[model samples]
Target: MAEETKVATGYDTKVEGEIKTDAWTTDGEIVEIIAQDPVTAESEYTEMEYRRLRWKIDLWLLPLMWFCYGTQQADKTSVSVQAVFGISQDTHLVGQQFSWLTTIFYLSYLVSEAPANYLMQKFNMGRFLGICMLFWGVVVLCIGFAKNWATLMALRALQGMFECTISPAFLMITGSWYTSREHTLRSIIWGTSNAGMSVITGLINYAVGQHAERHPGGLAPWKGISFFLGGLTIFLAVLAFCILGTPRDVRWLSDREKRMAVARTMANQTGSDRYKRSEWKWNQVITAFKDPQTYFFFFTTVANSIPNGGVTTFGNLVYESFGFTSLETLLKGTVPQNAVSIIWFLFVGIVTLKKPNLRFTFMVVSLLPAFTGMLALALLPKSGLLWARWGLYLMTVTGNLPGLMIWTMLPSNVAGRTKKSVTATVLFIAYCTGNACGAQVFQAKDAPRYIPGLIACAILFGVEAAMMVLWRAYYLIQNKRRAKKIAELGMSEEESRRQGLLNAEDDMTDFENIHFVYKV
Candidate 1:
């Protein structure tokens, strides 16, 4: 008992509870098992020193994530880009086959989320993710070689399975390094890679399309686009393997620095900078299911992503139906529309940083423009006014905002390794379902207008907005209940603080830890 008390007290002086013996570790290299509370030692380092450390971490980590995320988005959207460039004609795709190509990718992606997250937990995240990237790149490269619709479907399924790890893995890494408050901006920076890559890849594909138009007998422009993107993805994968690492594995920090890094983020209440925990607690998973908020998130993901599926898979094609040439679709349509999305991402990031609790507000705010856009697209006559219809289509990019908040909230709000993992999987399953369904809505028969699809998207966005409001209320009520329990316990502030810190160290889920407050 005396030894247990000593070890427990030794770990964090501010924490006044007994830590489980199993949680104690002699592996000081990965996670320092120091005698004093790290927060005190962290105070000795100057603020500038901490700033410099953050700068270094940002410099090293953000760019790699940004590039990797961008590449993944580029690869996914390449199908849409290639569609405008005659991939359908060349492959003799007809009816729903083209739509199925998009649908199958997300179908496979949905199936793979849980297992991929499990593998990430069991292995070195950087290496595991790197291997997934490398294989997916090869799969993407082989897509260019596909001769028919069946071959394309086969390769797209493979791509979906491999690409499943990117978002969840990136979210885990983001949470591992930064505090909840800091995660928003950094996430936007990397998350906006989707928009960034859209613009960059748009330019590249446009140039390539022009070249293919010049040399029709040589390699098809769509094939060249695939090969080039695949090669770039492989290069980025090698970089991820070489340079990308978890906070625990990062070579830049010393033993003391690693401890301080972990200590600095203690205020997050959400755990960060710890070695991987391989044991999967079934109880935590159960707790996640029992939590009402889990279902709300799942619903929101499905609702928001239904539109996302429509836009991402067919945005370029929709613009083509507006009477623009394929190259004009790439340049005038895809690039500018994505640029608008970039602005939305940056706008939300800035506002959220200045006003932290406004996440739900921004989520609702994001849907309105999309709702209006979809209404216009569905109701307005296509021949009424060309530029006006195009303007309305551009407004649909606002749909992406709610989805971004959903991603941000996963790391910010959820606690416990197993619960977090389970929640992410459920959320992504909804995401996949929504995307898969979204792709099928704009059937080939509905071409030019696709009124049915637009109407569906508009209604879903409103439902999603309502769900977001309800979810926010749920969080607010839950936090109040937790606060009442804390008061009823009659624990002193210091004791409560200590217990909270200990709970965080134990990797307790929000439900398991009574003092854990949900960030609204």
Candidate 2:
């Protein structure tokens, strides 16, 4: 009892119950928020209260995240849709010049990731990312005016640099707000916006393409796509800057609501760093580099993203090869394929949300469909299997789902602010590297069939599947090792819970916090 009390009272308390850290007087902001009324901080709220709070968070945060991500995705992949509508010809792109556009975008994205992640850790994530989106919107709008491939490449590079902050920032934001159980579903909801926006963007692009074809005097169809997407992105940026920030910074929530929000996520064991404010820990960053799971995440992202990069850039072309006209490809190929992706992600997300432990299992299972789809594309007779090929193309989109699952693991399993930032940096560097490499694989010489690219994609998905199995095993082993240590300590359930709550506020890395349990 004495030890538990000591643990609970690690920080000094004022008359008003404000927590004061020893090393830094004003740190542990979440703890301080809840500590204003220590008794309520220790007490459990009703299920109704938690549900109501979650509903409020969902209402305020998710839709904005969804819209923002959707706009980002549409802007990023606009070139793919534009290629079919005559951007390639208008810009005088030669062999592999088109592929280089995607490559340069990711190369810039790769170079910018480390610094972008550093800024995310040091600032208000929502505001920082909103500014980034705003700049990228301007770049995308400028892409509409480029008259040559060189100008397009320069604009793509700038877009990549500006947009590199989105994924890591979103990951951190999601982790700060949600519990491990809620992470999968919420991550999927926002993450699936890529596919969701595709459906929406695909319809708009098709309509614009039709109008451009009819009116000789109007702006080019490809340019129209960029103009519309860029404007939409700028509009969303205004909302994001105002409405979407960390719970600690948002204006809509009262102090009581903020405390409840922090208190509710205590079981996550991943400490909140939102209000900690610019405290960069070099040791945690070092530990992130040393951790074995970091490598797994890096390798898995590379493997999974190879297929993603190839297909994303060349999806419309692949569809065109399937006996469809330019406009028909948008309706038949891009729209339907992304529509399938939306359903697949939702089904996987719901199942994993209910059965949290099955995350890697679903990841591995998701790859199989895409693996089979790519194999069909690589080996089957291209002339006769039009509808069958279309269905298989749809299956390939499921491969992207596992990438979302990998991201969920970062916030739930990793602890410490700098460690999470470092891990995200490594993961995204791999993401950019893999996507850049994948872009080059679909060479112009192999156009229409692109057998080599299909074969490579199929092979990479298999590698991703194997990596998933290994990653799951590694997590299970780590969890069992931690559980054994906790068992040896002979702590009661109540004591363990207390210890976990204490650790949750400590900002300790997962390796340093013995009470930290891996969410396998």
Candidate 3:
């Protein structure tokens, strides 16, 4: 006689008497079941097959993300590029007005973070992000037509509000498809667009600058660059709507393939990309606030981004101040500097891929170059040794590394949907605040060499490095405490790992999942 059993909603069940396992339903209560011929498990993809599937997903997904990220960066950084090409002159921007352009953009970004992420979590990721991209693209194109600083700032503010969704949404999409071990490399591949777009846009602006110079009366080069980038952004937005989606929503993947995709990331111990609950959990939000890691990540974001804001928004100007022509600034200075950033991102990505546990270490390591760069920029005489100063300026690209690492941690380390959403919003709010504040430090009185800004950046880098060490230590302690609790339960290593995977399937938050181990 066959034996019967009952299982809860989450656990596997067996059927007897030729009853198909597919017909079994728990419906949030215990369900009666019996032993029968074992059904073939759905998650039976071989290691090689899994690798191939991952590659296919990467090929399908990453290029679109890369393009989206590149366009977003290009659109945002266009203001800085346009400043060099004569937007400042065209709009009659004077004194602190140029700085206000950056400040207002981030201010709007900060304000939009919570609502934007809420929508990202609540809606289809691809559609929502595409819509944002479309709106921001329109706003960017309108920027080309702005007649005064007030109009320029208004357009920039709107652009910031729309563009705020891209980074957090992409981070979630990346985490959903790839395991923690795979996230760094994938992230770097896309994140390097921060630099990649800079190079491409720099070249475009250089050509446009030359055109404006030659024509002398037609469309300003700044306006021309804006129109071109805006149009490209709209084109990519359409592609994003069609191509980009979460793992579960992609058309190319079969149902079985989607299951395998989620299964492969079980080691991350975070919940599925799909929402398990429609309502927000107040407890998770409270937990996130009380969590020390949250604040460490928050502080790290603020400290690191001050320098990034200073550099990204004003890099071309800084290069121009160093006695280079606007064309040389774009082609010679910004392009090569961003190329160095690409190298840094690629190097860190490769290193982390080979040894996933060393993410925090590498984050700290990447900062050394940035600190050195900022210090050199601060102390070096601005009047002479031009190439040396330029080299130091290039080193500041290391600031990009920490932000990338922080994003990787978000999806890997946080679990609950509400917690993750709230955390992302808080972190980005810190980012916007830092950038806004960073923009102000370089006042009009500072002019060519913003000595105060460079010095502040140097100090912030040192503080950020110290904070990274503290963040790592906090994770280590929490991991140790969790490990001890698991030991106290008398669970074997394999059993604990199994339980962790089970918890992942159940959509448990990091705090509720005792078996979960953070990837440091």
Candidate 4:
């Protein structure tokens, strides 16, 4: 271990724990990277040189991230458009049976989410994800040609398995590129994509209703919608292949821009660059399972997703029950609630900008609408169709709420590559579980009213809220214990400094030596 006189970085290195070169030094040897420049000086760089952003873009990092993810949301959820077509009628799908299609999809999704996130570091995620989009597009296209119920179910399962990486990969990439605070804003922006799904629902319905029923031939409208959406996915996937660049080896930009990008990346992420050097490790999973915080994250993801179950899978179905034609239901049904969600998301994004310390408070606000929406639908006794549509609009958007915190907790708290992989995998498994459970939440037996599922969702909100609060408390407890242990040692600054430099393989041992606190 080397001691060093502190100096800031000159350029971004895209390196995590270890530095490629020292930019500045005063008196001390490089004992531990007390204050890294977060940059890798170029081969020709002088001691005075620093990284610079040669190319400039008008959009800030957060907004760009928001748009990318928003597009992602719209792209993936397009299947909702197929609900009004003759496809379901031909397949003979009922409420419970319909739920299986969704249930099985998330089951596959659960199996894949963690591995996808873990692999993000291993593979060039942009290319891999784009390729996944291509795969899903082909699968969705194939779905349009499916003949029987069994055929549709199989296709849906395949679609979910492929799409699992889309979001987690986005999260992993976002985590790599942004800081905790910036991450939240982008989260909401991308979160607003949930609203975008509804925004397009009307236009999609108009197109499908007018033409799908009787196109050039007797082809079903839903099939047309599926084919069209699948085509769009393919187009985007191709663009991604050409445009998307790997964070570890982003060669699209100039050397200066690359350095700036890396430095900015390192500073924002506080060193996620290490994972780029390696693939997923099983040890990380074991550590993640033991971490109490991971459980809390899981609870929140599942809780929020339970309410989300109604929207992603059965949103159009719920609207159809409101005594409106499919076209009218989609048009009138989706707009108002999406408007509310859009406003709330932007508001929350701004309000919570200053409170990075209280991330859960924003999540709580997002859940509030979902809880109320479900309650209103369950309790109110109108045509039931009338209130149910509005309730669904509100409930559908609730999923975006916890999503912000879910991402915030991962990179902000967990550090090891292995731990990160495990945390992501287990959390996503819980995510799939929540989604799978949600697929089963809506029952045709409850029909028009569906009070049982509504109440189940509402009760779930309470449990979720409590779990989030408890998760925060657990971290506080862990932090306290760690502090007490440090005090008990009563080591001098010099001794403490001495112990900090060992580059041992055990992260648990490293955790204690570095005085790493559990972030809430």
lDDT of each: 0.82, 0.83, 0.81, 0.61
Model 2 earns a TM-score of: 0.93
Model 4 over residues 209-292: C-alpha lDDT tens digits?
777545647677777667766776777777665455434443354444444444444433234342244645565566567666
Better of 1 and 2 by lDDT: 2
Best by lDDT: 2
lDDT per residue for candidate 3 within 1-520, as digits (tens), equals 4444321112222232332322112234332221222211224558898999899999998888988899899998888888877888878998899999999999999999999988886777888899999999999999989999989989999999999999999988988889888999999999998889888877877788888899998888888988999999999999888778786555677655766675577677776543334467788789889777788778899997788787778878888778899898888798898898899889989988999999989888888888888788878875988888888888877778888888899987988778888899989999999998888877778778888888888889889989989888888888899788777767788777766654555555776677777888
Model 4 TM-score is: 0.81
Q: Which of the predicted structures, 2 or 3, would earn the higher TM-score when compared with the native?
A: 2
TM-score of each model, paired residue for residue: 0.94, 0.93, 0.92, 0.81
Residue-by-residue lDDT tens digits, candidate 2, 95-122: 9999999999999999999999888877
Model 2: residues with Cα > 4 Å off, grouped in runs: 1-32, 36-44
The Cα error of candidate 1 at residue 112, in Å, is 1.0
- Locate the minimum summed-lDDT window of 10 residues in model 1: 2-11
Compared with the true structure, what per-residue lDDT tens digits does model 1 show for residues 233-309?
Answer: 99999988877767666666666666656666666666655535777889888999998878987999999888888
Provide the global lDDT of candidate 1 against the true structure: 0.82
Error of 2 at 506 (Å): 0.9
